[model samples]
Target: MKAEGGTTCGNSTKNDSTEEVKNQYHYPLTLPNYTKAEGGTTWKDKEQVFDKAPKRIMANTRPAAELLLHLGLGDKIVGVGADFGAPDKTVEKEYSKLNILSDKYVGKEVVLGTNPDLVFGRGGLFDNSDGRVGTVDTLNEMGINTYVLESSVTGGTYTSIYKDIKNLGKIFNVQDKAENFIKELKGRQEFISTKLSSIKEEKTFAYLHITDPKELNVEPAHDETFFNDVFKMVKLDNVFKNETGEVSVETLINANPDVLIIPDWNTYDGSSANKMKEALYANPKLSSMKAIKNKQIYAVDFNYMFGYSYNAIDGMDILAKEMYPDLFK
Candidate 1:
């Protein structure tokens, strides 16, 4: 498990946005060409409406900040919190300039301190059970709007990401920027589609995470997440797509996937990928697996695989090249 170079692909797109996918609305939505408002409901099934674009916003996660910055709404973001992963290099400089409200999750008091009109982030940020950054309803009651990423609410898919981009564009009145970004993503997808079209067989891969170099967790394919959709885009099959929650090592070895897809948590803990891979390699039970024997394991950026952001396209591109390097070259 050696560190690999990052992709040279600049903001290319993924699988087509033709599918009819509904976006998760943490913020209010206005129907097109309607002068009067009829109000709207959120993914949480709560009522919310917006009369104008949010000013003095707060990005609650790294991907949220990156999306806002890419939309040219960086100035609108008053502060950021809960940034657990590294920001992509494209937005790294601008992201570094923003006021960090907190390194981990922000408390409700800290959120109110920013005096933001809206708090934008994935769905996880709204959990108020622990009372850190109150629930979406409480935030709305406090006169602040909230937006959850659609992908977070309704499984991770390219169509969902596209819908989110379009929705965010309309919400922030940055339709042009959002449309351009979507188009770029589509272009990249088309490039991948063309390059890999010659291949007829789909390779099987397992998206996994390892903590303590012993316990391995597999992401289910049928789950509402990005792995399955991205795997399909690259013409790969998920071995654990049918199973749910913590499949045993024996189950993984029994399934015997063609490739092992691990999230590179190196940023959080140095040499984590190497440690995990080393343990897997040293294990006697896993040696018979094709991925282990052929050394077909890939450690990808955690943000690219886990979050419901536009950056998933980068993750898709990385997978495409990794499995089919000859075609890419």
Candidate 2:
């Protein structure tokens, strides 16, 4: 699925000098005594059992494709479509090697041409009425299994993401890899939780979307459910939790969250997260806000804030480290 709203493109970039420096600090250390493990929920109720592993798979998004690669299923992917945003640092090499079905969303005919036994992506890729990749039922009738990330269906949360990962593991018969990966992610989550356990108060944060560089008008991202869950993990609260429609600058100034989470929309020309930061700095009305005064603003890649994928855990890690550097150290 595309980044929420037609005007913006969500992804991360390495070329930005500011982004470069922020990537330097890794999560300090996982606590040795944090004993909680991820729940043992299976995907039986959410998905069907595959007769055999799908050999020729067509991944409908960059996140879906990269997750497959991480699962050691790279050879099984016949083609990738709708790879939005900057590539993740961990999977860039493997992602570069995949066949590109389309730079944007692939059409139904193109998906059919690929002759994939399985097509996996977010729910947006299989919209029947919109005519993008058609419905899951249509694909199923054509003898192709369609798997939509459960996170997408359930309004996006880490729990739903885990389910999707577990389901994919069962589909490909790679339960060991899936379990191992989930364990690592859960460890990261526990690390963040353990670090923040000492905090007495929570900081307020807003995830902003800047569509026009010159105008500098910001809107709340559409995927608040996932980001909200991530924020809760890091001890940051969403100021716009009850908000609806376009959030005016006046409202933003009045709310004045402790931190501002902005997206790095790398897909557009002459538009970047740095520009949004600059725009925020230039605005006189926004100067009085605590996020500006304390310099707690962050510009993250689209995937970290909005994309439906397990790498969102990595994004959560980034935010946690940024907000509480001492905890990680």
**Best-matching candidate per lDDT:** 1
Question: How far off is model 1, as Cα RMSD?
Answer: 10.7
Off by over 4 Å in 1: 1-43
Score each candidate by Cα lDDT: 0.72, 0.71
Candidate 2 local lDDT, 5-107, one digit each (tens):
2233334332344433533342221111100112212222233335567889988888889989888788889888877765777878988889988777887
lDDT string for model 1 (87-150, tens) is 6789888888888876677877888889998887766556564425667767877888777666
Cα deviation of 10, candidate 2, in Å: 50
TM for every model, in the order presented, reads 0.82, 0.78
**Top TM-score hit:** 1
Candidate 2 local distance difference test against the native? 0.71
